[model samples]
Structures are given as C-alpha cells and as structure tokens.
Target: MGVIAMDKKQITLYYSSENSIGKQLNAYVESSGKDHLTIDISKTNVTGTQWAELADGLNKNISDLVNTDHPDFKEAYGENSVDLDDDGWLKILNKNPSLLKNAIVIKGKDFIELTSASDFKQYMDPDSAGIEKPY
Candidate 1:
C-alpha cells in the first residue's frame, strides 16, 4: 500500500456585522483561487442544530489535512486577545470544535477575537470565562 497525502484545507467563517466584512472576505478568497464555505448568521435562521451541522461538515472535510498558517487568521483574531460576555456566542463556540482557528466571533460591529482550537475550547464557555484572564 502506498501512503496518501491529503491536501491542507483552509476554512474561514466571517461573522461580520452589516454583512460587509464577510462578503468582502468571501470575494477575496474566491479571487485568490481558494474556495471557502460561508454561513450567513444574519440571514439564515441558524439554530443550534444548523450550527452543529456546519461544524460537523467542516470537521469531516478537514479531518486528514493540515492547516496552513495564513495572514487572515491574524487579521481576524488580532495581535492581542479579547473578552466576551455573551452566553449565546460562548455556547456556539464551545459546541463547534472544528471552528477553532477558522472561526471568528463578531459582536454587532466589532470583531471579538480569533482563537486557537485549544484556547477556543478552554475559554469558550461561560464557566470557563476565567481562562480569559491570562490573555
């Protein structure tokens, strides 16, 4: 049997307010010869189930691939970290493990932060909010 090499897949979720940033990012990615999947939280009736399904699909798609470090990640998350108080956002983040690095949390008109998969899991829950202290 021969060893198989999987392509590294990049996933980005743009949760921008007014739908501007997300749209622009989508276009930019597409023009750059990279395809991306998007979920419009503002237009879609994105229930917990829908979010779960999206997360599951993304996880399955990238299961065997590595992540390429891109400047977009830093741009989305910023050089420093952020603090959040919304339980709904926390719940969504905690439940979607695949969304770690690719996922971004936008609060109204502001981008909360970008998180690593591990850090995302650690500080995402309301109960785990204390983890934000170190950052």
Candidate 2:
C-alpha cells in the first residue's frame, strides 16, 4: 500500500505527552472546536519517515525538531552533541520521541511550531490574532 498522506483540511498536532508544552498545547487544540488530529508520540510509536515528513512540512531539518537543550538530550548526547546526518537525526527522533522541541500544529498548508498553548489560536482566527490594529 502507499503511504498515508496528511489531510489538508484537518488540523494535525504532533506532541509528546511527557512534555509540559505539549500538554499545554493539547488543551488549546482540544478546546478549539475544530476538526483536528492529535498524535501523542509518548504513547504511540512514530515512524522515522513520519518524523521526516513533519520536519519537512514544518520547513525545518530533523535536527531542528529536537530540543537539544532538553535535559534528556543533554544527558544522553552531552551538553554539546555532535552533528549527525539526516537519517541519523531521524533515527534519534523515532527512538526518542521525547526529544521533540515543541508541539507542531499543521492546518491545511499552514505549518506552525506552537511555541505556547495559545499559539495555535492565531490559526483559528488569523484576522484577530492579538493584533491591536493601531493603524
């Protein structure tokens, strides 16, 4: 069978339950009252190809998807970890899903790295995204 493609009309969330930011992001996503998909990498196993696709969709590299500053990453790879190739990075993510730096939200063609719980709110209503419209 062919690979399953992401639904352009659905909002997809990639997050780790073990991460606080991911947990917070979930709250916002769930309450949005919109069609969405939530993937908890903590309990589920995400494939290397899937992780790579997410990174690519987010306009980032595999390494960028990892929170290198996280304690777990630092403990396992050291304070200053060595660089690895694309495949190597994907392997790291597939094996250690907790290394995800932040919650990623994808709505249609829009891909956003949810920096905060409310970050996804902007996508819901782009016109009133905390802009004062002082002009």
Model 1 RMSD in Å is 16.7
Question: For residues 1-135, what per-residue lDDT tens digits would candidate 2 score against the true structure?
Answer: 213255666778989888788898888888878778898988877787777777787788888998888887888889876689988887777778888888888765556787777676665665865421222
TM-score for candidate 1: 0.30
Q: Model 2, clash count? A: 0
Q: What is the TM-score of each candidate against the true structure?
A: 0.30, 0.83
Residue lDDT tens for model 1, 14-132: 34323344455444444544333444444444454444433344443221111123344335545554333334443434443322334443222222333333433443343676633
Error of 2 at 55 (Å): 1.2
- Please list the Cα RMSD from the true structure of every candidate, rounded to 1 decimal place: 16.7, 4.3
Which runs of model 1 end up more than 4 angstroms from their true locations?
1-7, 49-135
Reference-based lDDT, each prediction: 0.37, 0.77
The residue ranges of model 2 lying beyond 4 angstroms of the native Cα positions read 1-4, 129-135
